[model samples]
Target: MVGCARVVNQTPTLPIKGESYVVLPFENYTETPYAGYRVASILEGVLASKGYNLIPRVWSINERELAVEEIEKLKESAVKNGARYIVHGSVNEFRYKTGLDGEPAVSITIFVYDAKENKVVKNVTVSGSGWVHESLGTLTQKLLNRAF
Candidate 1:
């Protein structure tokens, strides 16, 4: 069987093409180690391929999940870095189901903050299931592709 993904929720407004964006480290709510960083890397690649100017950050392996207050600080840092938009979210699920198929399942929520307007311009949630043969990374990339 092939993998499939669906959008759970999304705002009407899409991000403007060719805008400068800073992708903040996503919060990892799941037990999977570095799941947030994995998704963030995939998201960055996806956006970069679409021609968006992405500002890179030096990631620290010791960094912990971001707190609510840290999100505001990250947005401010994005603005200071001359990014027009800030992207961040949380990884709600990233694991394989323990059924006979051992199917891979992933769920994530993303938010796009417009620095210029000082508001959230977009919000999207996506989830998917992959066949037993599929890898979690591949399924995650596919789901994120559907998101933006």
Candidate 2:
């Protein structure tokens, strides 16, 4: 219960215009230690490919624990970095299926926060499994495409 923040009724399509944003490292709910960072990195590239102005990883060090602490101080940090928004979330699942024909799969939730207002502007969950021959990164990209 802070600021005028509330989840929007609908998630916006990607490449949000006229906004400089930062992709904060995401939480990894999965057992894989690097899954969160891996996905967050991929997401940053995807957003940039789609024409979004994303802050570089060098600016924040891609650390989840640090991001959590920084959320309380997001307004000041965002202002310093010239970022109007922050993207962060969790990787619920990141692994291949357990079967004779295992396929890469991932479940992730993404959120866009209005840094200046300290409010979430959008939230989206995306989950999917790829063909047996697909790589994890490729599968993740497909899932993100489906999400946004």
- List model 1 lDDT by residue over 1-148, tens digit each: 4445555688876677778898887889999988888888889898888788888663444456667677668778778878898888999999999968888999999999888888889999989888788899988888877777
The lDDT of model 2 is 0.71
Worst 10 residues of 1 by lDDT: 57-66
Off by over 4 Å in 1: 1-5
> How high a TM-score does candidate 2 get?
0.79
The TM-score leader among the candidates is: 1
lDDT of 2 by residue, 51-107 (tens): 788765533444334445664465456557888877878888889879876777788
What TM-score fits each model? 0.87, 0.79
Off by over 4 Å in 2: 1-15, 58-67, 70-78
